[model samples]
Every structure is written in C-alpha cells, then in structure tokens.
Target chain A: MTGIDQTSLSRSTSLKLFGYHPVVIIVAVLLLFMPLIANDFILYQIFSWSFMLGIVALSLMFLAGYGGMVSLAQMTIAGFAGYMVAIFGVNGIASVSIGWPWWLAVPMALFLATLLGTITGALAVRTEGIYTIMITLAIAAAFFYFTNQNYAIFNGHTGINRVATPHFLGVEWRSTVPFYYLTLGFAVLCYWVTSWISRAPFGLALQGVRDNPRRMAALGFNVNAHRIAAYVYASFMASIGGILLVWGNGQISPGSVSVDVAIDNLIIAVVGGISRPIGAFIGALIYVVLRTFALDVLVAFGLDGNRFRLLIGIGFLAIVFFSPDGVIGLWNRWRNRHASVSTVRQGGAHG
Target chain B: MRRFIERHPLWSLFIIVVIFVFLWLVFATWPPGFEAIFGKKKVFLNAVLNGITLGGLYFLVASGFTLIFGLMRNVNLAHGSLYLFGGYMGFKTVAWTGSWLFSFVVAFVAAALLGIILQYLVFRRMEGQDLRQTLVTIGISIVLADLMLWIFGGDFYQIQTPDWLVGPAQMPFVTAIKSSGEAVYMTYPIVRLAIFAASVVIGLAMWLVLNRSKIGMIIRAGVDDKDMLSSMGVPIQLVFLLVFAFGAGLAGMAGVVGGTFQSISPGEDTRFLLASLVVVIVGGMGSIPGAALGALLIGLAEQLGSVYAPTYAVVLTFLIMVVVLAIRPQGLLAR
Candidate 1:
C-alpha cells in the first residue's frame, strides 16, 4: 500500500487495536473525565439528560437520515413508554395494573411503543414530504390528547408522578453517579446498535429505499414495509430512552410528550447531522449543554430564562439555514482539511 | 338506483350514513331515561351550538391558510404563530386603548405588518422552495410561540367583551319529545352569534375579492402558474407578498374572534394550527368553501365525538382526511 493508505490504515488499526472505534474512544475519554469536572447537579442535568436525548435522537436519525421519514411522534412514543412503565411498574389502582417487574414492564412498554410507532409509520409511509409530516403530526397530536383525556389510564393531563427508578444490583441507579453511568451505558448500547444496523443489510436496504423508493419498489422491495420496520426499531430505541428519561427525572408528565418536546427531538436530530449514530450523541451533547448553559448565561446577563428559548430558536434557524448537516458536517470538513494538509506534507517529503 | 349509486360513487355518502347510525345507537343506549336523555340532548345541543361557533372561527383562521397555500403552494406552518401574534398584538392594543374596536384594528394592522415584513425578510429568501420554507417557518413559529410565552405567561387571556355582546341570548324553541313530554329550549351566547356573523361576512368578502376584482384575477392566475404569470409581466413577487400578508391578516382576525369566543392560552396557537390544517386537508387544499365545509364538519364531528367517543375525538378529523386522500387524493375541493 502507498504511504497515505498506510497512514489511514494505521490510524484505523490503532483505533481498532484499542478495541473501539474513534467515536467510542472519544466518548469514553469524555465520559471518564466529565464527572470529575462536573458538579452533581450539573452531571444529572446535562450528562444524564443528554445521554437519554441521544438515544431518542438516534432513533430519529435512523428515520430521517437513513429511512427519509420525518416523524414528529418520536417523543410521543418515548413518553408513552415512560407512561407505561409508570402505570405498570409503579402505580396500580384500576388501570390495567399488572404490577410487573421492571424487567418485564420495560420490555412490554418498549414493545407496545414499537407497535404504535409501526402503526404511525405505516400511515405516514403512505404519503411523502409534507403529507408525511402532517400524518405523523396528526398522530402525535392524537396521542397527546389521548393521554390528556384518558384519566382512567394516564391519570388525565396531570400524568403519573413519583415513578421510582429501578433498584438494580442493590443500588439506587437514579443517584447522580449511578444514573450518569446508566445513561452512559444506554447511550453507548444504543449507539453501538445503531452502528451495527447502519452497516447491516437491512440498513442498506433502507438507505436504498430512501434514495429511490420508487426504484426500490420496482426492484420488488416492499418499501412501505421496510419503512415501517425501521420505525418499529427506532421506536424501541426511543422508548428505552423515554423510560430512562423518566427514571432520571423521577416523574412523567404530559409535558414530556408535548409538541415542544417532540419538536426539540427533531431539532436534536437535525443539529447532530442526522447521518450516523455518533451524530446523535454529538447533537444531543451540544443541545443539552447549550440549553443548560444558555439559561445561566442569559440569566447572568439579566435576561429571563424563558428568553433563552429565543436564542435557541435563533440557533436552530441558523443551523437549518446554513449547516443543514450540522456539527458533524463541520467536524468532517475540519478533519478532511487536516488530512489534505498532511498529505501535501508527505508529498513534499517524497519530492 | 343501483346504477345511479355506482355512477355517483356513494362511498362517502355510505360512510356518512354509518356514522349517523352509530350516533343514533349511542344516543339510544345512553345510560339515561327519556327525561335524562332530554336533559342530555339539550346539553348536546348546546355543544352543537358551541361547535358551530367554533367552526365559524375556524373558517376565519383557515381561510387565510387556504389562500396562501393556494397562491404560493407553501403550507405556511407559521400561520398559527401569526395568529398568536395577532392575539398578543390585540391584547397589547387593548392594554393601550380603552376601545375594543381600536384594539381589533390595531391587531389586524399589526399582524398585517408583521406578515408583510416576514414575507419580505424570511419567506422571500425561501421563495419557490417548499421544504426549506416549511422548516424556516416552523422555526419561526417555535420562536414566536416561545416569545409570546415569555411576553405573556402561560396564563389564559381574554379581551373584555363589549356590553352589548357580553351576555347570553335566549330564544324560545318549541319541541315535542319522543315520549309524552313537551318543552322549549333557548339559549345562545351573543358573542358566538357575533363571531358567526362576522365570519360569514368575511367569507363573503373574500369570495368577492377573489372573483370580481382585477387583483383577484392576478391572484388566481398566480395560483395557477406563478412562473407563467411572472413571465406575462405581472409583478408576481409583489402579488405573493400581498397575498401572504392578506392571508396572515385574515388569520389574525380569526385568532382574535376565536380567542374571544374560546379562551386564548399558550397552547391555542398549536391547537388552532392543527384545526386549520384539518380544515384545509378535509376541505380540499386551496379552496375557500372547502375550508369552510371542512371546518364545520370537523368542528361538529369533534364536538360530538368528544361527547360520545372521547377516545376517537382527535382521530375523527384525521379519519376523514385519510378517507378523502385515499379516495380522492386531491381532497374534497381540489383546485
């Protein structure tokens, strides 16, 4: 191999030699050092929430980036899963209270959520572009209102509160440090799964469908079914994140499933450059960090925290208008520039 | 008869019949005696009245949406935000002036100015691009909603009703019961009546403007083929800006009237936006009368469904939309 190939191959080999990808290495290093610098409250607020959000965004990335489906129901599905866990695992009065163990409850909730997502996907996949957006939006709206009025099941608009996190291995996993690690683990697992899926045959088929759905259908692929399948899988990921999200907050509210949250998940997916799994984590980190820190910064400058949302709105608009590929695109460009410069140096040395 | 039915494609009519039968069965088996049923029916009648009022308000809001979508082919998701902004502007105007009329005027003018500026600044950049325009407008809507929340907290707000329109009006209605009972029921909100009247007037005015005027002809031409119209020496860009501003202004008026009829809250923007979308989708995109019919159908269906089948209330409008799209992808009144 040539020297350039040797360099890239050596870099790849070194990363693999350390038993992880570059993304994993970077995330691992950051996670190891983050808590040291972060306070307990900051760690819980920023790190834990970001990780949970990362999983939801990861699901959205699969739909938007790979499957080309723009769904506004990701947050609703996640929130539904959270509600299921709370209803089934904690509070038990008259609303189908099986009182299942956390293991069983979580899985059941995720499965139900996946089924719901698949239904939504089936409906949405029938349309394209703006129509798809409207159908998913309608579904999300229906869920939001359903949860609000179904007092028998979801306790009406008040929603279920005081949901205790799972006590696993004789430790309250919701404690700041434990929760941080739990979120980290979930995020990592989700990321790894997404990476595997992205490289798999199904992932390739989804990409093919997204690129040219008509052609894919002409080739005898079941486009709508594949799209629905992606939604099901993505919903499972989001539902897990939703369950973890409730655990982190120790409560589940209708506000969690509101259009704002749904739109926020969309923003995270877009901001992270909805192209890959690593992009979700990167996007989530930026969003959570900026959102958390922007409040303090705005407050310090004598602005209301509510006004911080204006800044976020501006930031989101700028990102969509300018860098539709988001932060990941910026990073890739930077990396490419460095590689090109190094190659030029290597050529000069050869001369 | 069978051949006539086949020629007419009576699927929609059949669906309507099934819905009516379902409603009849639900009412018959309702856990109340005849006397109780009468009382409940009165309540339901009140809800129907409320639904009609709400539907009129919806028509006002959705009319502008239909117009803009027809002319520009942009969904204008920010139409809802513009509505909310209009309410806020009117609220501020009310705070400024003691007169409700002045407040209404200020609200309309302020929303119109905002719409014009937005068209020039944001949408102008996104002209001819639907998806990009949608995203930008969505961002704008989110920002505007949050800004309003910041400006006016999440608390509900209502403009002060004029003395004449503040109270309920009672009209005597003679009715014979199914059983051996006779009764008269009469009750209606004057404000709701006023809203309906105003909406009809506005709708009539909009129809006239679209049909009889030279500007209306330009708008119609613009909607048909914007590129051709622009090539034909029409200032199509100016026409779009004007149409968009006019539509937004109409949405603003709808907001004030609807907000007054209902209650204006932080969430009203999104809710009304969804309702407007349902109206547009069901009515047939780009048709004023279609929006009106869609609004009335959705409003009545929503009201009845919420009372009878609460679980399906939200899905009822969408069900109609889905059926319409499946059977006639162009919608009920496709232009």
Candidate 2:
C-alpha cells in the first residue's frame, strides 16, 4: 500500500519538525516589533486589517489547497460569525442585541458559524469543480440577500453597529497595542496550526483526495468526511478572524458580507499562493497596502479614486497570467534558480 | 378522465386544481383576504406578466452562459459585465442615431468583438484550467465594471425603444374580477411583449442552429468529448472561439432588450449575471431548454415574491435554487 512507506514518512515528519528556516525567524521578529515601530493608523488600520483578512484567506487556502474545494462562502461564514457576535454580545444597537457576556457569546457564535460551514460543506461536497464554485457562490449570494432583507435579526441593510470589543483583566482590547497583539497572536496560532495540519496524516490524505479522489477512496479514505472536517477547521479560523474584524470595525453590516468581499477572499488566497498558509498573509499584506495607498496615488495622478479596483484587477490578472502559483511560487522559482547557479559555479571550480 | 385519474392516482389532477386555485386567488379576487397581504389583484396580474417578460430576458442572457459552459467548460464570470457594457454601448448608439435597431446591431458587434479578444487573450491561455479561468474572468470583469462606471458616471440609464413599441398593449385575456363582480382589464407595456417575442425568436434560432447545422453538430460533439473531437480533426479551438463570440453576442442582444424595459445601472451587471447563474443552475448547466425553464421559474418566483413579500423578493429566487439543488444536485435537465 502507498501508506506502507513508514520509513520515508517518519523521515519526512522529522525533517518538517526540525526545518526551522532562518527567514521565518527574521519575519517573526520583525512582526513582533511592528506595533512598537508603526504609528496608530499603521498599526490599527493596515497591519491589523491585514492580519484579520489574512486569517480568513488562510482558511480558504487550506480548503482549496488540501480539499480541492474552492468555496466562495468563506466570507459568508466570517460574516455569519460577525453577525452572531453582534446579536449575542452587547452592541450600540441595544434594541436588537441580546447583550450576552463575551465568554458565552463568543463560543456560541463560533459554534453556530462552524455548524453553518459544516452544512455548506456537506452540501457542496456532492459537486465537483465548477459546480462547487457555483454552489458556494449561490450560498453567499443567498446569505447576502437574506441578511439585507431580514430586518428583525440583521437590522436589514444597515446591519448592527457599535459592537463592543472584549474587555477583561483591565486590558482595553480595542486599543492599538493590545489589539495588535491580540490579532498577531491569533494570526500566528492559525498559521502554526495550518502548517502543522499540512504535514499531518489527515492533511496528506486530504491532499490525496484533492489530486485524485477515486484513488484516495480506493486506498480506503472517506473523502467527503475529510472534506467536511477541513471545512469545520477552516470555519473556526475564519470565525475567529470575523470576530476580530467586527471588533476592529466596531460594526457588522450586510455590506461586509457582500459578494465582492467573498470574491476578494478568493483573490487574496489565489494571489498569495493557495498552496501555503504564509502566502495568504503575504497576499493580504499586498492587498491591504495597495487598497490603502492606490486610491491616494490615483487621486494624485488626477485619476478617479473609485477606480482603485481597476488597478487591483489588473494586478491580479497579470499575476495569474505570469505565475498561477502566486507570490510563493515566484519565490520558490527564484530560490531554485539561485541554488542551481551556485551549484554550477562550484562545479566549474572543481573542474 | 376518470380512468386516467384512476391510473395516475389523481396526483396530477390534484396538482392542477391546486395551481388553478392559487391563480384564482392571485388574479380574480380584489378586496380578497390576500389584498391585505399581497396588494391588489391588478398588481398580481401585472407581476405575473412582468415575471414572464423578465424570464424571457433572463433566458436570453443564460442561453449564452449555458452554451459557453457546455462547449468550453469555461465559467465566464465576466458575462454580467459584458451585458452591462453592451447596454451602455446600445444606450450611446441610441442617443447618437436615435435608431433602436442600429443600436442593437452595434451592441452585438462590439460585445462579440470583446468576447473574441477575451477568448484569445485570457480564456485561450488558461484553456482547461477552471479556477484560473474563473479568476482571470473576475479580474477582467472588475476592470470592465470600473471602466464602465467611470465612463457612464454611475447613473442609471435605459434605452428608448422605437416609438411603435413605446405604448402599453391591452391584454384581452387578462381580466381581474373585482369583489363587486366587475371585470377589470389589464394592460402591459408593448416593449415587454417585444422583449418576450425577441427572446422566443432567439431561442428558436439558437435551437435550430445547434440541432440542424454542421457547426452545431460539431459543437455538440465537442461538448461531449473535447479531446476526441480534436483528435478527429475538428479544429476545436476555432469552434470554441466561435461559440464564445456567439454567446457574447447573444448577451449583448439581451442587454439591449433588457435595457429597453428596465434601467441599466452599475450594479445590473452582477444582478443579470446572478440571474443567469440561477437560471442555468436550476434548469441544468449546458442545456438550452434547461436555461429557459430555469429562467421562467426564477422570474416567476422573483415577481411573485416581490408582490407577496417585497422584503424577501431576492431571497425567493435563492430559495428556489436551494430547493432545486437539494432535490436534484445535477439540476432539472442535466445533459
């Protein structure tokens, strides 16, 4: 059996455990000091936004890369969690919110969001490829419409506003430094968990299912269940990001769950590199930076600021056309070329 | 009748009766109990008629979507943008020349040319890669949408149909009975009828070309087995290009027709695209008849829901889609 290669599997697992690259350490160190170096706007608006968006994109990356399921409902799932928080937790819209404590509301919101993701996953796993995209997109569209219309719960199009952030142990989590740390901690935890999962047996089996489900099934794997499980894990990650996002914005609105945002999640995951978790963060950084600055640049050039999406679209197209594997793929190619060049130089010296 | 009923267990008859009762309640009872819920009976009739015409417009857009998907396996998310672009072009042409026919032709040609460019530049390179193609099309759509907003100034615009089709036409068959037992005749916009007629003609023409012509045969074969068709010297790329252009041209035509009756706004691109998606998904992907059927169901659901439950109109179509998908995941008419 293909699963019988125990020696190579153990060796690979050990290598993964010990393979702490220097670049990762350097990047981590830099991120740890970001809030200290950056100003309030930079810390709150750019970095925190990037981390939250990155977390959601990372969840999408896990599903698409490992489960072969390109779901368009990732944003919808995030939005659902945000809505749950708004409904259960205290908010400015006091009439609508039930005003539950953070300790109780957070888990309840995450639970409901996870259930929604599992149900969607169960429905979506029946289809393949393009149909899967259609189904997830339909769900996203439906959710958007439902929330936009259902005034009793979602407060109609305006959504619930002024959602209060968690306050515990005399820490004002909404402050820049504390919020940044909170976001960073969650981001790092998610990234680490996703990386660990990628090397785990279930993740390997899911990848097998992604490449060839029939072969994986022949090898005694329950493909759909595994896919559903992946969705659950991804939903938890996205739910956490969504809670953070709502706190960051201090609101939850129907606009936040728009189809454009859903598509943006896909674009972020794709532009970063769908195969790796780190790529999602890298892509989020690029996207947030561009979104923040591109409008200013456009207005400076006497162009319309509203057309910033045009530049982003163009960038996405160019990136996809040039490198389908995204920024990570480009990095890998460059590294390979550098390694080959050095080896060639060494061979010449030996000759 | 009794023997037939006995053989079929009366389920069909019961369904017909239920439908008739629903229609009666919707169309013939002014000041009825539902008036409190769904407005007046006149509004219900208008909604039904409106739904039929809207379904026709939806069919015009979705037929192209289905054709492309059936032939190339490419889900062109930019389709809605194409529709909106064509509408804008048609609007400009009409403004310039005041000839609805000329505007229609110009819109079709421009959209077809754009489609050709898209196939060669973007979709052609991605070929069978569905995810990449989807992303590329989305990118193209975003740029096109932004450009259109820039040029069109984010205002809602509608094409003016010819003077001959501007007035309302009296419908002899549609008579709503008031509570006083008086018959109230209903009138519908002539442009709506024209739209329905145009859609029917387009649907028939497409059916003929797909079923009768040699090119149609080749397209059908390609949809079934692309690799086999290519190996048999069919020049599948040429067929794909032709199909893509033709599909895009159909969307342009739909834009013109839809623009005549409804306002074309910046957001209409995604709306039409979403409608077309719902149609194809419910009717069955890659099936022309399925697209038509699905469009009709969605149109009726949307209109009826708007009248009965205005707040939930959008959700109604989605509900239909979800129900259909749950019951038959391959859709109603999967090819």
Candidate 3:
C-alpha cells in the first residue's frame, strides 16, 4: 500500500520510455537473449526454477499483500495442480495416468487447482489474519501427508515420473532453452497481469478489504467473495507455475509438495517483499540461488556444506529481524535515505 | 452443564446418545453381530486405546500452545521445536544417567530456559506485533530444526523406557469369548497407560493451578488487560515470562512422552507442529479445555481412521479440522 503512494507512482509515470520503463525494456531484452550467454544448466535449473517459484510465491504475495490473507496452502494448491497434470496427462505410470493430451490435461489441472484454492480460501476466510496461516498450514500438512501416503492416485512417495511435457507447434517445450523462454514468457505475463490488475477495481476493492474488511463491507463490497476470487486468480497463476515445476523435474513427487516447500514459498514471498509482485521473483531468485549454491558457499566460508539450511535460516532470521517487509523494503529504505535530496525521476519498475 | 443442555436441547440429546453408545461399546463385550460389523473387538479396543493415548500426548503439547496464544496472543510457531529439543535432551539424559524419571526435569528445565530467553530477548522487543512474532518464530524453528539435525543427525531416537515400566499390563476388558466360555482380557503396554495417566495428572494440576491459585488470577487478568494488570502493580512481564515458560515446559515434557510413544527424528518437529496447529485451531485457540477436546477428537480421528481406512487417515484429520472450522470457527470448546 505504501509502495503505491501517489507521489512515487505519479512521479514514476512522469518519466517512461514510450509508456514502458527503459529498465524494464532492457531487462526484458536481456532475459529474451539470456540463452546466448547462459548454459543449459543455468537456464533450465536456475532461471526456470526461479521463475516458477516466483510465480507460486506471486500467488501467495497476491493473497497476503492485497487480500491480507497469508495462506500457506498456495503450494499445496499448486502441488495439487501438478499432481492433476501428472495423473491426467501422459506419465510413466500407466496405471495412474489417464493419458489425456496436454491441451485437456493442462486446463483440467489449472481448473482443479483453482477449485482447490477457492475451497481453501472459502474455509480460510472464515477466520481472519494470523489464523489463516495456521489453518492453511494445517491444510498444507494434511495435503502433503495425504499425497505422500495415498498410493492409488498420487503414486505415494515416488510420485508420477517421466511426465510428458507439451510438444506443440514443433517445439520441445521442456528443453533447456525452449523451457527457459516458456517460463520467462509465463513470468512476464504473470508480472504484467498482476501489475495491471492491481490497479483494476477488483484489486482496489481487495486492497480495501485488506485494510479494513468491516469498512469495505459497509461500502457494499462482498469481502469474502473478493478474497476468494483473488485466491482463484492467484491459484491460476500458481497452476501455471506448478505445470512448469513438474515439467522442469519431469516428475511430480510428494517431496515437492512437502510442508517445507509451503514454508519456503512463504519465506520467498516475505524475503522478496510481500508488498509487491516483483518481490516474489526477487525472493525466489535469492532463495533458489542460495539453495543451489549454499553448499559451496558454506564450504568456501570454512563451514560444513550440510549447514546450508543453517545459513538459510540465519539469513531468513536476519531479513525478518531487520526488515519485516523483506529485501524490497530494504532497497526502498536505502534508496529513500540516500536519494532523498533530489526528486528522483524514475520509472515505476523497481528494477 | 444444565444451562448448556437447556440452551441447546437437541444438541445436548445428540451428545448424550453418542456418549451412551460409546460407553456401551467400550464397556460391554461385543456380540457376534457387533464383532462382524465393527471388526474384531481386540482391534477396535487397541485403536481406541491408541487414539486416547495419542490424544493425551497431543493435549500436553497443545495445552501450552493454547495457553501461550490465549494470553500473550503469540502464535509461537516454534513450540514443536521446543518439544523436539526436550525429547533430544531427555534421550541424552536417559542414556547418560540411565534414569528415566530424571529426564523429564531436565527436558522441562532446558525447554523452559530456552523459552525464557526467546520471550525476553526476541519477543519482548517486538511486542504486540502478532505477524512479525509468528514470522520470527518460523525463522527460529527453521534454525532450531537445522541445528538439531546437525547435532542429532537424521536417525530416529526414542528415550529408553525404565525397566519398571517396560512391560505390558493386564486389563479386565474382555476382547473375545472362548469356546469354553472363558473371557479373554486385553493386555496392553503398561508404559503407554502410565504416560497417559501422567498427562492426565499434569492436566488436572494445571487446571487446578489456573482456576484456584493467586498467580493464575494474575495471569488471567493479564490475558484480559495487560495494561490494567500493570497499572494494578502486577509484574505483567514476569507473568508473561512465567506463562511462556510453563507452556514451553509442558511442550517439552510432551516431547519426551512423544519420544516414548513414537520415535523423534528430524521431521518430527514439523509433524508435531502441524498436529499442534490442527489441535489448537480445532479446539479453539487459547483455550486449555478446547485443546484437550480438539486433541482427543483429532487423535481418535487419526487412530480410528488409520485402523479402518488407512489410506484416508490423514484426510480424516484434515476433514475434522475443516468441519470444525465450518461449523464452529472459534472451535468446539472455545470460550
């Protein structure tokens, strides 16, 4: 809310590159041509995973930031979509897979994930604020245990392996370069949709509800409905990310949907700055980078490699302890402190 | 009780009938038809017992969670870490000294000391900020869990049962009838029953202290109005510290109990934390009796569901939480 102040937003619009920020243009161009500079491993493993995680965390950010509902079940809902895709689409496990084409399977998965998120949101809206965290956490744990133990539909711990990715328009979408572009495309689309819709009437109303539900209800808005709808929208976003996630791994497993993942997504959202959409991507990039490289980082620092989690925990603690709004908040503060002398003529894009 | 019955007559009658049926099933030996429908009486009894015993452990953990939440409005998401830490400490103590009884004291003291430090050092600085406090707890839990893992490794650890309480004890409940008409009595693990009894005693003691003691009055008053209590010359911070420590100590002892019933491992922290969350939510946050009822219902749901429908056991627990949220969002026993 503070980030959307009239001074900053109007000032941002005062300077733009033909209605788009030059920085945004530059970043887009770089990402579009990233495959030329980055290797397949970097593209597929690092960038793609970052985008997918960012999208999921973006869902969480949408709900928590605009709706004031910090639901921990977003990952579970996303995992449900991933599982739905594996079960409905072609997978190695013939017994569980329905072997539907990607066209049908993808939509089915998204719809089901949206339904799951909507149902979870409906239940979660029964409470308010922090209770949502506990309720959704319980729901997430239940979903994890259910998927982990249920062999018939979920394939238990091993999950559904060798899930066939979309091979459409004569392009292998799962390949490193192609998949990087696909994920980048989704990421850009999600970011645009989020920023665009955020100024829409629905987003305003949702933010109103977040600020004060009683006041919003008095203003003739259906509070729960807006919250639930936001969940549906966010769930759709997460479903896309989940599909990418599953496709990236070539499998969907119970381990991927564990409570740890749910918590990690929350960490990402919070660390990135739950107040903004870009924060989710930033947070996810940082988390994924640290998680991927923490072992070497720890070893380089004369510490045990297995203490990667310890480093993450300490980093998370420091982030939470110092800047509750996360890394974006820290950046905003630093920028405000140093650049306060001049009316910093800048575009709206934090990048 | 009379007021409740008169206010909700139909609900009261339904509850009475349910209780009567449950008691009948527990007390009376099943006939051939009953046995056919409900599976073997032995299996039913075992599941029921396991559920009740598990409920006892859950109550121990959740009571503190509710107490902490009820008063301080702190979610303390790291309560499960305290439990695991206590369990590890108990395991170590029992191994070093071979004294099962002394481990509880060590576990309680260790966990309570950690709780005091957290409340004083971290939580005190961020007073009245519920979300931040919860987030900090999450960070703390993550750190604690990782540290514990680094120390204890991934292997499962169960505190050694004392020799005096290591064997099964005979109970007079008839599971079946022999051809010669000799009634078969059930023999259950004595350790589980002993632990259950201990939890029951702890619960009663807590109830008595809260309801009947001077400190309890101060604590209750603080829960209602910290400013008012402080104005009234009560050391509100001290009360908060005591309550937090007590709650944490309860969770710690529960860790030992859980370690006895089921092995404690790296993942146990999350598992127990989830269980406590479910119990607290279903039972109504900040209510002790609510925690007990929620714990019992959830424990029973988990055990019976596992016995009858193994695949959907976790689903059953989830369903109970969902239903509770839907029907009584505050919880079944919330004040």
lDDT of 3 by residue, A86-190 (tens): 899999998899999999999999999999988998999999878999999998999999988999999898889999999999999988888998999999899
Model 2 agreement with the true structure over A1-351: per-residue lDDT tens digits: 022122233332333424754556778889899877899999988899999999999999999877779899989999999999989999988678999999999999999999999988888887888888888887888788889888888898899998989999999999999999999999999999998897899888888888889998998999888999999999998999999999999998989998889988988988898767888999999999999999899999998888888898898988788777788767755655675675322111100
Comparing 2 and 3 by lDDT, which wins?
Answer: 3
Clashing pairs in 2: none
On a 0 to 100 scale, what is the lDDT of residue A146 in model 2? 84
Best by TM-score: 3
- Per residue, candidate 3 scores C-alpha lDDT tens digits across B1-335 of 99999999999999999999988887798989978887998898899999999999999999999899988999999999999999999999999998888999999999999999999999988888788889899889999999999999999998888889988998878888899999899989999999999988988888888889998888788778889899999888888899999999988988889888999999898998999999989999988888888889989999999999999999999999999899999998887
Ranking by DockQ: 3, 2, 1
lDDT against the true structure, per candidate, is: 0.78, 0.86, 0.89
DockQ versus reference, model 3: 0.67
How do these models rank on TM-score, best leading?
Answer: 3, 2, 1
Model 1 misses residue B276 by how many Å? 1.7
RMSD of each: 5.6, 4.9, 2.5
Show where candidate 3 strays beyond 4 Å: A1-7, A10-15, A341-351
Assess every candidate by TM-score.
0.88, 0.92, 0.97
- Fnat of each prediction, in sequence: 0.44, 0.65, 0.83
Residue clash pairs of candidate 1 = none
**Candidate 2 — which residues are off by over 4 angstroms?**
A1-19, A300-302, A341-351, B1-39, B178-182
Candidate 3: give the clashing pairs: none
lDDT of 2 at B79: 94
